[model samples]
Target: MQIKLIAIGKTDNSNLITLIEDYTKRLSFYIKFDFEIIPDIKNVKHLSEAQQKDKEGELILAKTQTSDILILLDENGKQMDSVAFSSYLQKHMNSGIKTLIFVIGGPYGFSNALYNRANGKLGLSKMTFSHQMVRLFFIEQLYRGFTILRNEPYHHR
Candidate 1:
């Protein structure tokens, strides 16, 4: 199955972009991986937090297809270890889905509609992380998961 990560806003830090690209390239060797960035919502200063989330949610929803399984990267999501996450990836692949999409929402997080639409929610950590950093961490974890699935030395037992 093809895996896609969709996040809002551009990552301006050159160092973070380079690292994210490195992992993305590494991940391509195992599966079709796509990283998409939704431009940040303009005039956010004029909008309420709820309104901002609503607008961002609409953009996020528009990127997805009806057949896609959407998973939100939420702070309150189900947290799992690396091995369990690898198994989760394996399960999705075994299910024969075309694409599994994971979304990293904007500053205020997701909208009510997005929460209702998600098939699942995953938390990378109990601690908060910047959206840009999450991209790198998540991609590297994807690479690690694939390596673990292959019994490679990338992940320590």
Candidate 2:
């Protein structure tokens, strides 16, 4: 299965972008991985939080196909350890799905419609993280999960 990570806005920090790219390259050895960035909504100062989320949600949904299993990287999502997350990846791969999309929403979070459309939600940590940092962390985790699946030494038990 192909894995896709969709997030809003560009990551301006060169250091973060370099690290994210490194993990992305490593992940490609195991499976097809795509990192998509939705441009940040314009005139956010003029819009309410709900309206911004609604607009961002529309852009997020538009990138997906109906068959794709959408997972939101929400703060309140189900948290799992590294090993469990590896198994989770294995399960999804075994299910024969074409694409699994994980979204990191905008500053205001997701809209009601996006929440309703999601197949699942995953929390990387109980503590909050910047959207840019989440990209690096999540990609590295994906690489680690694949390594664990192969019984590699990348993940120390």
Candidate 3:
């Protein structure tokens, strides 16, 4: 199955981009992986919180096909260990999912519409993280998940 990570805005920090690229490259060997960045809304301060998320949600929803399973990266979402995450991925692959679309929402969070569309939500940690930093974390976890699946040395039990 193809795995797509759809996030808003580019990572301005060159160092973070390099790390994200490194993990993304590693993940490609295990599964079809696409990391897409939706441009940040211009002059966002003028828009209300819900307004920004509503507009961003439209763009996020547009990226997915009907067959895609949308997963949100949310603080209040389910949390899993590395091994469990690998199994979760394996189960989805076994089910023949066309595409697994995981989303990292905007700074203000997701709109009600986006929340309604999501099939599931995953929490990396209870601690809050910067949206840019979450991109790196998610990519790295994805790489680690694949490594665990392959019994690679990258993730130690």
lDDT of each: 0.96, 0.96, 0.94
Model 3: weakest 10-residue lDDT segment is 22-31
Cα RMSD to the true fold for all candidates: 0.6, 0.5, 0.7
Error of 2 at 47 (Å): 0.5
Q: Give per-residue lDDT, candidate 3, residue 104.
A: 99
lDDT of 3 by residue, 15-121 (tens): 99999999888888998999999999999889999999999999999999888999999999999998999999999999988999999999988999999999999
Candidates, ranked, lDDT: 2, 1, 3
Collision pairs in model 2: none
Q: 1-107 in candidate 1: lDDT tens per residue?
A: 99999999999999999999999999999999999999999999999999999999999999999999999999999999999999999999999999999999998
Q: Which parts of model 1 are misplaced by more than 4 Å?
A: none
Off by over 4 Å in 2: none
Q: How many clashes does each candidate structure show, in the order listed?
A: 0, 0, 0
Pick out the ten consecutive residues of candidate 2 with the lowest summed lDDT. 126-135
Off by over 4 Å in 3: none
- Candidates in order, TM-scores: namely 0.99, 0.99, 0.98
